[model samples]
Target chain A: MNKREELLTEKQIRRRTFIAFTFLFLFLGSAILGWQWLHRQPTDHGAIQPLRKVLDANEFIFSSLFSKKHFAKTYSKDLPLPHPRVNGKIGLNSAFDTATWKLHLVKAPGDTLLIGIDEIKALPKTEIIFDFKCIEGWSQVTHWGGVRFSDFVKKYGLDEQSKMMFAGLSTPDDEYYVGIDTKSMMHPQTILCYEMNGKPLPLNQGYPLRLIIPVKYGIKHLKRIGTISFSNYRPPDYWYERGYDYYSGL
Target chain B: MKKVIHKHPLAIRWLHWLNFPILTIMIWSGLLIYWANDVYRLGWGDRTVLKFFPGSFNKALNIPFRLAEGMSIHFVFMWLFAINGVIYFLYLVFSGEWKFIAPNRNSLKESWLVILHDLRIKRGLPPQKKYNAAQRIAYTAVIIMGLGMLLTGLAIYKPVQLNWLCAMFGGYEWARAEHFTITILLVLFFLIHIIQVIFAGWNNFRAMVTGFETENIDAKTETAMPTEPINTKSETDEQA
Candidate 1:
């Protein structure tokens, strides 16, 4: 009985020692695997869907929280706004007769109104001097004078509860389309700009009309606004399909 | 008729070893990034106590003045560092290993006693099975510091995008300063850890590497002992 007890005790001792060693090994191996896994390229598409969903949810919450901060600065008139060279013009390929040009406001079914540039000039004009930032990590300061987008929205009685989830801007031939977020479209800084540097916008700078929004990147500023539409569905964004965050706000 | 007993598991040994290279790479790449804006210092006015890096240090390191490459490498490796850290944390938490690493209520006082004993100012040592009180404190502190580094790094990286996080760290420049300070503390911790490892000598080092140690079992309870009887010298140990 004594010998048997001794043997059992020895076995238990060895097992305990073995368990300790096992734990050490588990931690060490896991740390190494973790290190390697982190360095590996992000190739799992199954993982990305969840991440994108989280990002979208977080963005909505964060944007709503930050929008209430009353933070705006006055820009000096003497500050020279750098004129960055135009990179690409997608929808402005075809020419349109100025006399025939009409800024269409799509309302109820068959209730669309054909408004001219002279009609836009008749509204209250607002001029802003602000910086225009590009995603390529460069910025330019420019003076834009135009009618406030909010003014038009209010003129047309577009309230916060409006069902329009999408805002679409297109060039004359509709070759290019840019989408604006409803929040940005209703922002006081967003304008249907017609003049640059105290003169009517040059032909190269979207002659008839363009978007001047301080809250967004330069890519969303669609030049030569031919038609503005309000829709329930998401409007197709020019840069979004090419892999960019949809809510590309400042 | 005696054999060594395994102490450290294979996993722990690998993780302990793997940390060396990953941490080294992170620090090296971080230095390269800091070279772009090395504005850290530890001095009151022009007293000249300590600058972040001496001119000689920069010369030896050969850090480039341009930020472009430094930024690229830093950004790329940051993902790896963060992912590894997150996984390590989750593993510890889920596997119940956090109990060992996390300090108990007595840890602070015991850590001071352990330090005194290690410094040879005190005779008796604290009761320790796996980690001494000092080790517990150091390890726990480093994890917390790692969290600080991650937070401060994010604050600096996306100041406008993560404006709230930036504000939490007391704004952009403060966050940068905090990040650099924490990094310096980590490097100091590494230096001290290596020194302690060397001080602990061959048996401790071998245990870490080979996952085995030669612990002695008394002749009277040789079979009852948890470890195998081996050639281990033990001086008289006083209770804490």
Candidate 2:
């Protein structure tokens, strides 16, 4: 208890009550109006424009502070998921043509490199066992084996293209696509995955090739990559257009 | 006859009231985020008594499939919540108001007595100050809970950038669980707090809103009650 209790007159108490409620209403009123205005704004992709704008700002701050020195923690390969769950099938068309599959690499539109699974396997292989996080809040400690995306970029002589603001990947049918920061793509753990649990990827798990990026949510791990392209501007993404953050960094 | 006494400072009242709505919105938005992975339940090994929520409950609240909106509101309002909490903490310390809010060693010894009084098993409450022993402990615990929420929120939000912090909270998944648990505890605290305020009656509630309480002339002896018990504790651990 406070030793100095300021005894007040009834008149003083009434005046304080008036001031208090007046301020309280004003504060609460503004909060309500602010939320209403936020929701009423036009949509940017799936989110309202204002919310998207902040997300953009948040991305800028997060990306600036993101460091390559800090790697995502790895677990023992023995502890990896025996059967990883598959999520999101927007671009995964149930169609024909695993035989004709060639990874189309586009550097500034005209410079194209057609790569086969053999070419990726020729390069050094990297395996990572990390908690593969999904934006939906579930995660799995799964093992992945692949050629590093950075190695693929280096081997293809796309050093200049790799330095661009973003890298966009799309499925063969081109229905589902993802745009990612070139910085994240350059992380040592970002891989052009061809193997999962020490075997060739299953058909449903992006069979021929997929992206295994440990630093981001699973949504950025575009599957069955038909084409890889570099961009100075943000590329179209499946989830970004459906109310997810364009960056979606972990 | 009734005499009025200043029970709360103007700054304290504003901070407390602001917290109610801000926190309510935070919890609401949090529910939307947790709806995606609501795995927690009050049960063990197939036995179950309660679920965080059922499908019907979520459907009624319109709380399902609003992850984007929930995330947007949560990220935006987190700054407000943190700022309000920090300001409240600083004011409590600098204004010497913590003396009334923070618990002493005696609080632990006396809190059970206050509880018995609350259950109406005891005939009378233990002599106390601006806050009873139970109140002092609860208020202090809540402030600590607020801090836990902020730290846990940061750990999960930027698990990559703040890898050290994420590890401190026992990695990302554990941090998420901690954040969710703290929210549940805060909601429980809110339920009890509201019920107690109702039990305390309008005269006591007005003290929060108006910063003044009108005391019955017959209870003037309480003027002495606030000092004697607390002065003894001051010599022990009141301010320690």
Candidate 3:
């Protein structure tokens, strides 16, 4: 057989190279544009806001599509631990007057109810042994006993207000706060946890009361709940301001 | 006589190169997320053999306190990764390029010979085709691994909404482990792939980039290979 001809002539090779490079340039240009667009999104304390939007969208979809009745897996018993690890120290740094600290319940702007731990304890108590997952990726199987938030909402007639889309919780000093969807807040396992491992919660673990939300990461389980507010719009979250997801659900 | 053979189709080359950077970014951002957890290890009960990463390693790499940034980048880039993979797979199916990469019945046995040849334990390679048997297996396995990453990633990302998927992989923590394990495997595959590309020389690498390769026409006939190139002119001409 005669010598085979070249698959691509010089002109063709140059043309192919030009096309390849052109496509590559186009791809790079689009990537840069995407990066700029992401950075330009509305930010919270310098954290990219588009990410927050993405998390909210994810939460909305999950809430609408999935059943709220689906509970987190309950362990037969709590894991043996001297104490759970302290993952964050943002709100725990101050010395607060525990005796005078009242749980401020906000219905709307300027409409508030100041209630004590006794008022919360007056409701029926529920106990659960469930895995507590943290955004930091560690998990602890811990026992908690408290009044379910749903029950508390019903008893206080907060459930009557149907426009409430989110529940905001804050520490006494308001140094740290979290925003939670009302649906997650009303989950069967969500509680105003005051007792842990069959005893009153230690000061390090949010002494009088903390939010125990099984459906969410530990970040949403706001400790030392000092203020509770119902809002139609999403409340500003500490972590969300710091670039973490607001939903932060499992 | 020496001749040029149309090797990788233009679309295939584009997809392959595009995946390289997209996957690199995915793995890099994944590492950033994994740094927050960094819990995997290889050992028995507490007698540690190798931690996924030691504290010193993390410090050296500055891997801590970046979870927020890592997560944001990961969530954003994931769309690109998934879309690219889906497009690539569709192209493979539609263009009939799957035949070159997908493993066949004889691939396992032939892959053994290919491996032996690679290791220099055997004298010569098995008969060369568009892709050798080992290449077919490795390429196919990588695609499957990509799918695994996507599934496991979704399972963990929305565990409650996709609880069934999470449960299918033995729950949330297990799904996370599966995702990380597959990532490590893909990284391993990437390393081996690079080494093979270097060993295979410039012509092979050029084919992936330029869509053509120089071949000895006499050798092609001696091997009794089909006259048509792996990527026929008809397929590439339209793109050209």
Measured by TM-score, the strongest candidate is 2
Candidate 1 lDDT tens digits, A1-250:
1011112234444554577567657866776686567446352222223333443454475466435132222267798667755755787778777668888876655777788898888999999886565544344567889999988777766664244776877887887777776767777778899999889987777878899876676778888888888776657777655434455565
* Candidate 3 segments exceeding 4 Å error: A1-6, A14-43, A49-63, A78-82, B45-47, B218-240
Model 1 chain A weakest 10-residue run by lDDT: A1-10
Model 1: fraction of native contacts: 0.00
lDDT of 2 at A154: 87
lDDT of 3: 0.81
Ranking by DockQ: 3, 2, 1
Model 2, range B1-240, lDDT digits (tens) per residue?
235667888899889988988899999999998998888788889987788788888999999999877887787678789999999999999999999889998999899999998998987877888999999999999999999999999888878778899999999899999999999999999999999999999888888887777765556564655554433443345237
List of clashing residue pairs for candidate 2: none
- Per-residue alpha-carbon lDDT of model 1 for B1-240, expressed as tens digits? 234555555555666665666666677767876775566677788776777788889888787662333444455456567776777677678766667778998899999999898898999986775678888889889989988988998766554456678679986567878888898899999999889989998668767766665555467666665584332221111111
Give each model's whole-structure lDDT.
0.68, 0.86, 0.81
Interface RMSD of each: 10.1, 5.0, 5.1
Instruction: Give the number of the best model, judged by lDDT.
Output: 2
User: 1 or 3, which is superior by DockQ?
Assistant: 3
First chain TM-score for all predictions? 0.75, 0.95, 0.85
DockQ metric for all predictions? 0.09, 0.31, 0.35
TM-score for each prediction? 0.52, 0.91, 0.87
